[model samples]
Target: MIVLLGITLAVVILVVVTWMLLTRRLREKYAALWLVIALAVLVLGIFPQLLETLTGIFGVQVPANLLFSMAIVLLLGVSLHLSWELSQAEDEIRRAAEEVAILRAQVERIERAISSGKASGVEDADGVG
Candidate 1:
């Protein structure tokens, strides 16, 4: 039983590593998860008894694969939500920048008008003297 488990785990790891390499999906962001999956598989491969003991300690009755799948799904959903928020923020920033430009133009025009008006105003020549 242990030998069979080891062989199965070895095959799974090889397949996963090959897939990641081929797809170029070995980014640092997902590195931890990959490492965890790798380590878990390795441990399970080399020591099925140990894995059983650990599972018993943790009171985890569900299959490891099912738990891993759920985690991946949750991570994907959170990532998508974050991406959506970032996109919304980007749009808001663009609009704010446009508004700032408009206000800056208005201010410049106002300053120019004020300066011209001041220049054109002649204090009564006597008063100026």
Candidate 2:
């Protein structure tokens, strides 16, 4: 019964993630990661004996402990990845802001030159004055 529930939950998650990916709401990189996680859940749910084998191999006293450990590890990995992505985004935003500031200054200087030329009726090589 519990196995069936787990499988159902995994399937639901998989479907939702797929929908998000198809709608462009989720990036391909994140979709792929989520798909992998969902597939893992589905597999473990279908064959719970695998979890028991893993627990025995790891010398865990209880299967719940193994589950909790796996959950913690997965959460930590996801958190780390998100943090790295945020850092990269922050750097890119900072660079773009700096570029915009430089461009704005240049634009202001050009406007000042044009306005000053007009006020003094300066003529260029073309002599249009």
Candidate 3:
């Protein structure tokens, strides 16, 4: 009964992930990760006893503990990657804002000079009219 349920769930998840990928809602990189996870679930679903064997091999008494530990590690890795990406994005944004500020200041100065009859639109920034 439980085996059948696991297989069904795994198939459903795989189908959902594939559909999302085809619809362009999910990128190929993320889709590949989801596919890997789904395949792992499918394999475990197909061989329910594999977890038990793995636990024995790893000298773990409870299989759930092993799963929890693995899950926590995976989540930590994902969290770290996301944090790094966010930091990179923030730095890029800051640099872009600084560039924009510099350009705005230059434009304002040019407008002031042109209005004061110091330089025409045809002249360069160094007042080479």
Candidate 4:
């Protein structure tokens, strides 16, 4: 088991390093998060007892697969939250675009009125005595 952990840790380190190099992103940007995940997988893959210990914290007596399934559900919850925020932003953008279009049309109408009055040599009633 110890050997397996060492191997897994080495593999994870190598893969993370390779990814960071390929992406050209500062490792610090993602290093901490990936390190935690790699360490978790390495620990869990090699020491099943760790899962039992973790489950005990939540009063859970389920298999590791169930815990994995719960993680998937949590990811879906995050995705749903992001989707809701995007939907709200989209609605706000649409409303803003409509308002801008209306304002542009009003400005165009005013401009046309001014040009036509100039051509006809008529005083703007609102502006004259």
- Model-by-model lDDT, in order? 0.71, 0.95, 0.84, 0.73
How far off is model 2, as Cα RMSD?
Answer: 1.5
- Per-candidate clashes come to 0, 0, 0, 0
Ordered list by TM-score, greatest first: 2, 3, 4, 1
Write the number of the candidate with greater TM-score, choosing between 1 and 2.
2
Candidate 2 per-residue lDDT over residues 24-84, each given as its tens digit: 9999999988999899999999999999999999999999899999999999999999999
Judged by TM-score, which candidate is best?
A: 2
Q: Give the range of the ten consecutive residues with the poorest summed lDDT in model 1.
A: 27-36
What's the distance in Å from true for residue 20, model 1?
36
TM-score of each: 0.48, 0.94, 0.78, 0.52
Please report how far candidate 3 places residue 84 from its true position, in Å.
1.4
Model 1 Cα lDDT, one tens digit per residue, 42-94: 76677767756766676778557554665698679768966997899999999
TM-score of 1: 0.48
Question: At residue 46, what lDDT does model 2 achieve?
Answer: 98
For residues 16-126, write the lDDT of model 4, one tens digit per residue.
766885797645534654565566666667777777887887777685666687679767866786699789999999999999999999999999998898788877768
lDDT of 1 at 13: 71
lDDT of 1 at 74: 66
The C-alpha stretches of model 4 lying farther than 4 A from their native spots are 1-50, 57-63, 123-129
Off-target runs (Cα >4 Å) in candidate 1 are 1-62, 122-129
